[model samples]
Target chain A: MNRTQLFEQIKKKSSYLCVGLDTDVDKIPTHLRSAADPVFEFNKQIIDATIDLCVAYKPNIAFYEALGPKGWESLQKTLEYIPKDVFTIADAKRGDIGNTSALYAKAFFEHMSFDSITVAPYMGEDSVKPFLKFKNKWVILLAHTSNPGADDFQLLQSTGSGKKLYEEVILKSQQWATPDKLMYVVGATQAEKIGGIRVLAPDHFFLVPGIGAQGGDLAQVSKFGMNKQCGLLVNSARNIIYASSDKDFATAAKSEATKVRNEMENLLNSLL
Target chain B: MNRTQLFEQIKKKSSYLCVGLDTDVDKIPTHLRSAADPVFEFNKQIIDATIDLCVAYKPNIAFYEALGPKGWESLQKTLEYIPKDVFTIADAKRGDIGNTSALYAKAFFEHMSFDSITVAPYMGEDSVKPFLKFKNKWVILLAHTSNPGADDFQLLQSTGSGKKLYEEVILKSQQWATPDKLMYVVGATQAEKIGGIRVLAPDHFFLVPGIGAQGGDLAQVSKFGMNKQCGLLVNSARNIIYASSDKDFATAAKSEATKVRNEMENLLNSLL
Candidate 1:
């Protein structure tokens, strides 16, 4: 989806929420195991329950990949099942050299038809530029990740630019892509830094993870991270999807999503 | 395979050559397209031809992932077909948060059973630590890549440590893994910088890509990068695998691999 289309969805939904489909087979309701494809069945219900409440659905590729070929099938089904108006993200942290990265872009953007795929910026420009070649497809590069390991190399100060590695990633990447095709994955755990990041790329969107179960405060992220366009897709996975283990799991998930959406509604109203 | 086993294999073969099975369906000989599971058939022939000449096989995951579920099936079959003595590498540059990374490790290490998997170090310690938890498996981190874009963030000098961004990746990553389990990708194109990288990571093995097709000089990489253990696996992909487009494609691939192996043999003898 293009920036305008995504912004339209957010405005219509009143929530820039992206429900992460990090669906683990072991964690799904026990009764679904008998189904031919439990993972897809679980995701179908989740999408049905929460599609109206959120503007995007992010299926973390690792969760599906762990299950092997069948997992990929589940992921494809989930992608096909989601409403076209809502955006889809292949939360696969993929990046390589130019030619190899082109195949990845083809894999996620062409074959699977995800509107965006999260890419690791470690390999630098050529690794990321392939994804930007596709119109309306987004490249959400990893910035200050929420994980404990974000401190490893991303926070280091570059002597040449005198900018933190993540800052440099944002700054340098702008040369390759505009706000229309690029976004940053800024962890909600680093909410305080969101204001600073906003100053760096004020127009670009941020795919904010680490909320809910990861303990990131939504209010803080919404306040500091949102731009004039409400440039944030706050992802909440486990807390919303696995809210109940009973037959009413989908309903329970909808209730959790509704609560989050209600809060996002208030936040959007405050912006207006 | 463990470090000792890998070194022993290098000693036995008298070569540190890694055949990258970047088997693209479109690139394979026209005759094979008629066969069922053509990508696997192409890889099987390539592996069968080069198995004696090379000690390792590195399958760039993008080639397989691009074909969807069938591509993954081909990868699994190819992994199963490789000799147990030969080290297998999933050239899947994947990394995420702690819990998510564990799943990727499980997908490649447990389900696919590769000897090693290349990981991107942008997220830091926790993103890489899960792969280390698996016994006898290796984590080859991207240091200085071969692509032109490597100059973007990797070569930038870090103010805090007075090290280049790639150097800081090597230095900081040492705290999370030992030389026995951790290796770094020092591209053959960066042969001039190999000496300084060897000083920082003297014992860790280097998975060197960018040979013939990418204009990386094998002799330069060998002279500057080799250590006491002959710690390098120089990879040659397109130049070797797509050496010919006829029915003699397998033989052509074998001939190309043999030439690279012969050069490596001389280099190893010189070191001894």
Candidate 2:
């Protein structure tokens, strides 16, 4: 579950895609609703069908959280089903005071058996450091988000230093943890600037979401963002998970995953 | 509840207090452990005992998320148990892509009835605007945090702007939502600089969370951070909820809440 193991898996699979499990109940095909736990069943199929084509599985916490208790049960079962060789991320953007954060780290890393959890950097170092205390776990900090309103503050020139707030976060957070346990979320839609970001934190992995449905170019991201280790975890959620709404939804998901993985294979090959 | 309604309750109670329901299962009283759902039972008692003394109840999402399915059930029950007159906040620091954020807004405001939610401003406008779309809801943005390592980025001056990152977040987030639908998380521990922050965000309410265990001076925060409308919701989580673990835990919680409210009343009186 450590960074080295994660990187080795990425190489062995010839893929860096992290399938995002942002499953919404109403959005899933109607046929699966009758299952004991529809969400878990959906995730289980996706994992079984495409585990070899991905290096990571990211389950956004909000989706499970929305369903309340049943959703949580699905999340726990889904986590248990994911192969240990593949990295698991509880895409829960949690950040709080130190003590509270320590408990959060324990929840995802120990209690739930996740390899990592997404953390919001807005709360500062103490909030993030608690998660960093766990060995072999990664803390994915939000950088330039893909949303249209990302310009409101993240891109605003800091009144004192004149750098964008995200750039400031990238520079400062480097002191809290190394590339091994720290990663940055550089939205794939922000591909143009990935070159600049790589310059700042050249060795760290970047959890690049926003590909597929978000309109981010895969080749562009690979060209500008890739490091010696192919430091990019390109995530595709809607395009893969909901590729087909029929009873063959799992099979459809695997095909979509393979397509993306094939494209990534080409990108990784070019890297060498 | 709208901002005006929250203000009225604050004045009526003579308390600008927002007790935090960071209900950690590990820390719940041993007696409650035998209950079917100890976390919910513990939260229900806390809400019943302190509902009259405080204007709002803010629940940190991590504690609920830690317990998985059962924990989420406790959170839902606790949210429903809170009185209609009091404001409810899902203290989830959520900010994501615009589409994903819109779903989060629906989950918290429409699906569930939380009146407000804390948000990380790192993603800028689109990530925050989704939360503001609902009527009579508030998006409390993270500004200068109460954590020790906030200096990592929030305190750093922009490369040329001469303004700190937190100051920029306060100023720019104004464009995304009006003060009526938005608030800022200005840490109480940053009392010395509250005067400066008040100047930048004079109209927006601030959810200050470092008063008790963090050693922030309530008086200093009131003097420097308060506005004409008494726009400060000072929060004390651990110091109040875990005030005493004895059988009189609820009574001890009420006493601690009363002490903060009394101090706040004095501050309000002086401000007027």
Top model by TM-score, which number?
1
Q: Write the per-residue lDDT of candidate 2 for residues A1-272, one digit (tens) a residue.
A: 77778779988999999999999888788888898888988888889889989999999987876666677788889999987899888888788878878878988988798888888887788889989988788899887777677766677566665567788889989998999999998888878899999999999999999899989999999999999989899999999999998888888999999999999999999665
Docking quality of model 2: it rates as medium
Q: What are the fnat scores of the candidates, in the order listed? A: 0.89, 0.67
Q: Can you tell me which runs of candidate 1 are displaced by over 4 Å?
A: none
Query: Which clashing pairs does model 1 show?
Result: none
lDDT of candidate 1 at residue B91, scale 0 to 100: 99
Isolated chain B TM-score per model: 0.99, 0.98
The sequence of per-residue lDDT tens digits that candidate 1 reaches over residues B1-272 is 88999999999998999999999889989999999999999999999899999999999999999999999999999999998999999999999999999999999999999999999999988989999999999999999999989889898887877889899989988998999999999998868899999999999999999999899999999999999999999998999899999899999999999999988899999766
Error of model 1, residue A128, in angstroms: 0.9
